[model samples]
Target: MVTHYGRAVLHATRHGFRVERPLQNPQALLRVAVGIVLGTVVGYVLDQQMLCVGAWLAGLGSMIPHQRHRLGVSAASAVLLCVVGPVVGVYVHDVTWLLYVLAFLGVFAGGMLMMFGIGLGMRAIIMTILMVALADLAPDVPTGLTVVKWLALGGALGWICQLLPPHGPRFATQRKAVAALYDALAADVRAAAEGGTAPQPWPGPLLAARQTLTVLPQFSRAAAASLFGLVGEAERIARNVRVLQTAEGAVPEIYRAQAAAVAGALSDVASAVRSGRPNAVTADWSSGALSRTRSGEAHENRVRDLVDALTEAGRLVDVPDAGKAADSWQHTELTLLHSQPGFVARGLRRLREELTWSSPVLQHALRLAVAATIAEAVGRATGDWGGLGEPGHAFWLFLTAAIVLFPTFEHTFSRGISRSTGAIVGGLIGWALTLLPDARALHYLVLIALLFLYLAFRSTGQPLMIMWITAWVSYLGAGGSSAWTRTADTVIGSAIAMALYLLWPTWQSKSLPRLLASWVRVEGQRLGALAAAWADPSTADPIALDRMGHEARAARHKFDEAATHAESEPVHHLARWTGPELRLLSRSVHEVAKCSAMLTAHLPGPRLPGVPDAARYAEPLHLVMSELATAAETGAQPDPGLTSGLRDIFGAELADTLPAWQPGPDVFGRVTHSVEELASAMHGQEAPEHRIRSARREAH
Candidate 1:
């Protein structure tokens, strides 16, 4: 009968229990589990009463798996705070006014420090809050130290457990992503060689490269070097494959066959990466048709160059230490004396700069300080003048305000909604659990499960974190069926946060234009440098070219971030309407960047004598870029003469040598064409309806 009942429930909820989630990171779970168990065991061995306290205190560091150095810092941080918190709490318990003042100042300082960066600000404020809360819980300074030691021991044990894993679960994901990217590259090459269009590598695999870079260092220095090296080789191979596609029609059939062989070589390289073995990539150049191709010598030479580039890329990949850096990868670990670099200096500089009161961070800080202060005060007033007593403890109200308020108004609003909803749901669950038999044991188990889930879902989304945090808090506080008090406090706090933002909103749309302008300007300058170098290699400075590239990429990143923020605004009509324009702008800028990269790659090479350099034509190209930048910034029209002049120069200088140069000569024409389209797009001109229709037809 029991089995039938269970089967019925399982059958009914089968679909409901299904969820789509990314593969879990087992290392994260292991870290948390090890820390909790270690801390609990140590505490229990020392004193049974210390078991829960030890896990609670040490569990903070175990919640997230960071780099080795960061883990150390986190452990030290947990230890220091655990020791200091209880003592501070005791003192604050005696002086209610001091507690209020410290709470205000702690949050205010945290806000001010946050201007430097979120990491710095978050750590400072969170640590301070922990200290104050711990102080209240501790009976005296001596007992606080004991709790601190146990907590530190647990945190330290968790940190030490990180050393046991040879490579983390994230590292495996990184390796797989890199392998997938190479596989995609190989497939594209094979497609192009088979007389088909080479499909672009999907952006998903490319974006995953960034994730690989982030986690590679945490695994091992050797792995980091190998991965980075392989990535560099993969990039070269990809570029060469793209060049082959561009020159497909002109190249002989034999070269296409060779491309197929090269694609196989790339596949081998990818296989080697997956299998943890470095193997030599072999490509057969034995095809006698290479020497007998009817295609002109220029076409033959270009094909040979492509083949050689691919061969060299394969050879480089086979080198075991090609990507290894000599320098140590370990950053400075958290210590009592040597803190994170720029923490003090940058913090002070930012604070000093924001003193004029115009800084958004300062304004936000002021808002947060004011809102949190009021919340704390109200909580104290409601809880027998300090909110320290039972039943009416108002700490949850202050916590709600602290968590809800964010740097941007949109963030605050969104978090306020999600947090309040999650809190209500979680609180109810906690209340329900309290009514069950063996509730005490169940609470401990639930808390442990929540801790694991929180870490696992940290990178996934915010909803789960909100739910778990609310449940965790309620289970610790409310021992009854009614968690209504905390729920009400959360709602009230969220309302206060929303009201403060409404009163003093910081709309991202207001600043997006400036960011866009900056992006355009930097991109224009980068293109100018590339064009100048192509015109005359003598003018090229590798350092300057690299700096411009970095700056341009940074500008684009900033533009994207600002645009994201702007789009999140409640009233962003301007941002919404400019989406298409921004997309066009981004595409044009990327094309320019690609042109620069191609030119940069070809810089130290064969020069044709008697041919005019890009120097004569560079001025008009630069002017076009400058005009585009101006148009992006001030809505000015780009002069058509710039594009026309470059065209005329291209005809006069390179028109006669077109056959000899073949694809290389076409670079100038492509650049000029791109400039024309960019200028037209900037002036609010979409592609002709005929062209759009043609593209759609082709796509279909």
Candidate 2:
């Protein structure tokens, strides 16, 4: 029977939505099952009584499933729903039209405030109204008028369900999520690092994880960015391999084999990336025997293709011996920390997480308080707080309640809108059920079934769970009676809730640009430290490098969040940035990272003393290297002064090159001619048939 409501959860778990936390939670399961048992017993009691009574109370019990130990808040909610709603229904009974008007207002008011854990805010309030109406017209004297008692009982029952002990261990979700990510990542990186692992490895899990990682930039910006970059690079490499593979009939055999090897390596990286279980990754270099055996095959198409891509990557990235670096790789237990350069790079990446309300109690209670306030306001507005129907001494009662329960300060408008709608609808439904005269038992069963079904379907629409509650209450209030009234009550609640939320609003601070700025500021400091350490020779900066991995992972993640938000939002909006602004941000970050990578490559290790040669000057090593970095970071041309300063600091001479790369024969094509003239000057062999410079690089 619990399967009815539990089906959604079952499906979610069955599909294995992986996360860092372990999936097993025995304690949570216990809590849910107990709550179900208790709720069922209470439901059975109500079944023994007026079937409508069981339905009304059961609707209230649903709240318990989420808020296990928050007895006070849940009880308060139940009281508001069961007692106040019914009293209002009774007092206004003779004037059905006036009562209807009041019910509409109440629902509208409830929806405006906030919503419960799940359903649409408006729907919940309207359902409360529906329940009250039913109890009001019942033959039995309305005990629901004793709001205090009913609310307390309902609240306790709900709380019991919420606090049920889980069947699984804690942090299961967190561990699993983290593990799943690393497992994929490890496979990809291992193959690339070791060389020629496999081709056409599956990427389904890795791709999905990539998408998830995108959403978590603030959580792990550097890692996220690096991962995404890896994906992009892998895809590009893989595609190139495929193109070469497809043209094999006409292309040289060596080229085909080379392409295959490159494709295989790229595919490995992609696959390793899938297992993002950081702790599980292991990187091992192929042994001497393996490397020696591969030397002869190096001239083959597969080896050549692989070498080409790897060599190109090293040259572009400015990482020395990158292709050969894989030769010395060793296997170790995979961890995200081990994946990156090390310490200094990985620094302080754990910050910048999305801050949910720190305490679940506070979050839930705040929403409830807002709902209650809206309910009371509308109750008073409709004169539901006055006359015989009104509870005795309304002002004092409200004052006391207000003192005890306060709404959240910042989320006032949004919360108010959601809760207000839910409450008003719930109230009317309860009231109408009092008027129902037939098939009460069947109505209860139907309401229970509908509740589960609604929970299942409500993924996106009114996910706040206002409508589901509203419908439930309508059943309780009207009980196999008028469907039209329930519908009216539900709509009224929605309208009211929307008004409350929109009429007055508070600013949502912690804007994206600020988030972006914070990431840059923190990452810059860490990178600077890493650069300084790496630049110092005779000092092994292993630890510093290790830290860099952390900072890089974090910074990349944060920057992504900033970019996504800044790119999407116009500067006209408060605390927002335009696409150009985001580009500027992106450029700065790219340059900064490049500088750090360069420092990592050149600074940390022993450098053989040698003067800057004429060839080095011709390349303008400092200036050429700094161009992309400067363009990215500042969104401007490289400052000549900065270039001059770097050259002086490094004791390097500038190399001469064309002013710019252009398609015309005079610019890039001229440079290519010069390069071809000095072909041996390039250490890595050039692809004999390649003509990159001749192609004339266009403006990026």
Best by lDDT: 1
Local distance difference test values of all predictions, in order: 0.57, 0.37
How far off is residue 223 in model 2, in Å?
A: 26
- Candidate 1, residues 285-332, lDDT tens digits: the string is 434433344545344554565555555545544444532441331211
TM-score per candidate, chains pooled: 0.72, 0.42
Which residue pairs in candidate 1 have backbone atoms (N, alpha carbon, C) closer than 3 angstroms, thus clashing?
85-134, 85-135, 86-134, 86-135, 89-135, 89-136, 90-135, 535-614, 535-615
Off by over 4 Å in 2: 1-38, 46-170, 183-437, 458-466, 479-513, 536-559, 562-576, 587-700
- TM-score computed on alpha carbons, candidate 1: 0.72
Candidate 1: where is the Cα deviation over 4 Å? 1-23, 40-74, 80-125, 135-150, 166-242, 248-378, 381-413, 438-443, 452-460, 496-499, 574-577, 597-611, 635-659, 662-666, 687-700
Determine which window of 10 residues in candidate 1 has minimal summed lDDT.
Answer: 329-338
